[model samples]
Target chain A: MDVQEAEQPVKKAALSKKESKLSTLTRELKKGKHYYILMAPYMIIFTMFTVVPVVVSFFLSFFSFNMLELPKFVGWENYARLFLSDDIFMISLKNTLLFAAITGPVSYIACFIFAWIINELTPKVRAFMTVIFYAPSISGNVFFIWLIIFSGDTYGYLNGFLMQTGFLLEPIQWLRDEQYVLWVVILVQLWLSLGTSFLAFIAGLQTIDRSLIEAGAMDGIKNRWQELWFITLPSMKPQLLFGAVLQITMAFAVADISMALAGFPSVNYAAHTVVTHLIDYGTIRFEMGYASAIATILFILMVSTNLLVQKLIRGVGT
Target chain B: MALFQHRRIIKKRLNRSIPVTIMLFAFLMLFGMFMAIPLVYAINNAFKPLDELFIFPPRFFVRNPTLENFFDLVAVMGDSWVPLSRYFANTIIITVFGTVGHIIFASMAAYPLAKYKFPGSRVIFSIVVLSLMFSPHVTAIPNYIVMSQLGWIDTHASLIIPAMAFPLGLFLMKQFMEQLPDAMLEAAKIDGASEYRIFWTIVMPNVKPAWLTLLILQFPVLWGTNGGDFVYSEELKTLNYALEQITLGGIARAGVGAAVALILMIVPITLFVISQSKVIQTMSTSGMKD
Candidate 1:
């Protein structure tokens, strides 16, 4: 009886503690109920469209599902096949990495440099230049104009120009030839790449105070490069980071340009990318499980690379 | 004497050297030309007569321009089973609903996220930032399943609903809203104003530039969406898809295709030009806070 009495108070104590924590959470939620209400519409749709799909993709990566039968558990077989057996995937991974490696950094620097130069212009010229630089990106689906330029015949612009100049005796199939497809794709991608990040950089440049440059001059900064490194870069670190995120994502996701210009499944899969591979398996082959695994890998690659870049960007001005 | 001597500082020409300035201008002109040429060609191609289009040593500028391609485009669009207006209606429906809903919802959400110090706010914002790092292609298959489950596969909801939650608009809105002073909100609260009233009457009107900025960004995206995968019904397809079909009519239709491409390109560019200053103003405050 005495032992039961002692244990009863202990049980009550634990129960009361848990209840208090629960009550505190409820109290906090009640206090912020209006905020919750305000955020509900966007948060609900966002979860349904964005967040839930990512979680489902991760889960489905472990199962073999074709939307016909039950999703059968496959463990690591899909991933194993992707790594060891799928030669096309390896090619795609290589192509995607190469594409991202070249376009990502080049476009990022180009965006900043162009914005910086354009910023130095008079306001009238700056706006004109902004529109000129930004026109390619905003002009939707006009990338096919590149097709007319690179069209594999003498009637095509490049071929016509080359033949007219006697630079080449014959027209080259720019989009068809394996040797030129990736580079052609890269060129178009870069042309379209000075997009959101460029605008952001221009805006970032505007936000930098004028006094900082004058102060830097008095502090014995030698040149424009020194001023940029010590003063301008540190001041716009936020925009730099923002631009990095936009560029990195656009860089890694290079399927649309490849598909539009080089043709889907380009000669020998020369322009094949991770996203195109995902599209192939998911839409064409209907191999949902394998495609999900590919997506999971891509998701990991993008997120990890962004985290690394963010870490590196933190050291920019220091 | 050196310390007391006044240093002349020209604000406009802060750190310019003549040779460097000349070199910069030359570089700018070269790169700018590379960027401008294709756009120029597309516009010139649209105005070219069919004969001029096919001429050997294809010209960049039209020597003799005509509206024949535009007339041909109308004729071709007239011949389709679905009228051109149906596609126009669909595109309008998608873009208007998507852009409006995105602006309203993102602003509403950003208010609490920017102003309130509540539980789960940090976590929610972090998720949004993380979502921006990856493209939607990764979620395509799963999203297809989701759309089918919701019976939104053949409907405009598939396009409109997903677009409303596009993380970029929300991110920008949040950043811009953070710059709004807390004292303003506090003053409203002292006047016994409710959160909803304070938000609707006070916060929104003050952020007009941000709204315009979101419009400029979101308009082009929704305008150009072809509704490729989620939509299947012929009637439900967008203007972009229809135009794309016209362009696919091969070499004989090149002039008409250029006309279509020109029409497609002009709307968004025009919108950007009209709103350029406002967009830049909003973007000035769109800096991430670590």
Candidate 2:
């Protein structure tokens, strides 16, 4: 033991030097040669599939380049036009932001409430209930659901029901009205994401230690809602942050819901999120440059919000 | 002693009928039915004949069911403007390959992010997570242009390859891997195992729950419908996509489209049910451990 202790200092010093050198050497190979080797396939595919298009789209969003014409650079003209003159684009952004801002918090609360119920049940009942609830996230064809709710025809189910119930004297033009179309969209969006967000919340709720709740109870936190507020919410921080991002992304992109329920960009563009607008100006119109600018704006917003969310997660992790 | 006996009886009663547990189950059952009723109605309608479908009230079941729609679906399958089978094949190829490929590739990539302390790993991980927040629709035009440039437009490659770059799988796998102990890797390394060997031997065996969760999440996202019926080309269509094309754009295709939707939903639902047990097992292990 005495000999081992005496040699430990010399051996540790030598080992540190050797370790540092070897790590540097491994780092160089991994980054310079091996790293690229590992990452090359994804990078190549993503570049081919994602990056190149983004670059090309930056060009397409400019100019009056329809599908037939060669894309001509129109500088900041498309964006300037959108702000200065495009009533539809302005309306789309406003509606999109409003929907996202409102829905994010609402869903956050709904998911928590849903999760609380699931986790409170017996394991067997919880699993059974979980599968039952999650079925919707995959079940309905988006178009089918939209058609059922907003068939636009007088005989449409919702329209027929409303008329029969005497709530409306005449069948309403459900999808066409710019005022009501947005609500139909909001309803569908909320309905569709119930499964994924609820599942995520359940996962979060399951992670919380029972002991903490017991501790809270012992500390005279006798109220059930108080126990939840002080104990349950803080424990589920990782999921809280994750669910926030999921909600933000879902609410912002709401493009397909718009397309399905109200057609592309929606009537008078009331429901066209910035994304649908990007697709219109860039893909259909071939204004690649302008699309890129819009995309970059979206990318910036998404990433910054995501980073802010990650910070919240890090605080919880620590 | 009398007080203690009384308390025991009360405790047993409370245990059997815990208010929290009752509330949770009731809430779950209510919402579960709410979410499931539409699909149930769709399936019930699929087997019903046309006369039974639009009853004055609503028929939960049909007295005389027929495979007439299935027969019609089959007979009129290719006879339709777009071939149903061709469309089904296209969607299947996209969904199956995309889900499987994502699982394989994401698992591979996640190994380094979760276990390796290599430089720039944090940056790479952050980028992947941040990408999750970006709406794919914004990239629709860019992706379309890129696909056109590659001559991949309307091909399954347009759907499959682009969707394969999904970051959700990687993030899920990374989070799952973090739960594994470093001691296992250290012990394996002490035994002279290479990093790859450690990952495969030790790490791979433990991540079954994460994989199932990812598979469940990704398949529908990638292969799900995009609100159009009929791709305008008979050759490039999918069964559901073809069904979607029903119209003078409205009431005529409602029943037929509902039939197709019922059939289309079966595959994912079956896959989910088959894997759900495995998912439960893995999750239970981790949940109980934690």
Q: Candidate 2 regions off by >4 Å?
A: A1-39, A50-75, A140-143, A150-154, A307-318, B1-30, B54-64, B78-82, B190-193, B225-233, B247-255, B277-290
- Tens digit of per-residue lDDT, candidate 1, span B120-205: 99999999999989999989989999999999989999999989998999999999999899999999999999999999999999
Question: In model 1, which regions exceed 4 Å deviation?
Answer: A1-21, B1-14
Clashing pairs in 1: none
- lDDT of candidate 1 at residue B136, scale 0 to 100: 93
Candidate 1 residue-wise lDDT, A1-318, digit = tens: 999999999999999999998998899899999999999999999999899999999999999999999999999999999999999999999999999999999999999999988887777788889999998998988898898889999978999999999999999999999999999999999999998889999999998998888888888887778888888889999999999999999999999889989999998999999999999999999889999999999999999999999999987656
lDDT (tens digit, per residue) of candidate 2 on B1-290:
12122254243222223465456556666777766766776787678777676664444556688776677677656776656677777777777888887776777777777766666677877766666787676566666556667777656666677666776667777777777899988998799997667766777788888788778778876556542221335576655556667533455555576678786776666666767655433332221111
Q: Please give the distance, in angstroms, between residue A309's alpha carbon in candidate 2 and its true position after superposition.
A: 5.3
Please provide TM-scores, in order, for all candidate models, with all chains considered together.
0.95, 0.83
Candidate 2, residues A63-164, lDDT tens digits: the string is 546556776667778779778887867776788788877776676677778767666555666666667666766764734555654666654667767777
Worst 10 residues of 1 chain B by lDDT: B1-10
Which CAPRI category fits model 1? Answer: medium
Q: Residue A205, candidate 1: how far off, in angstroms?
A: 0.7
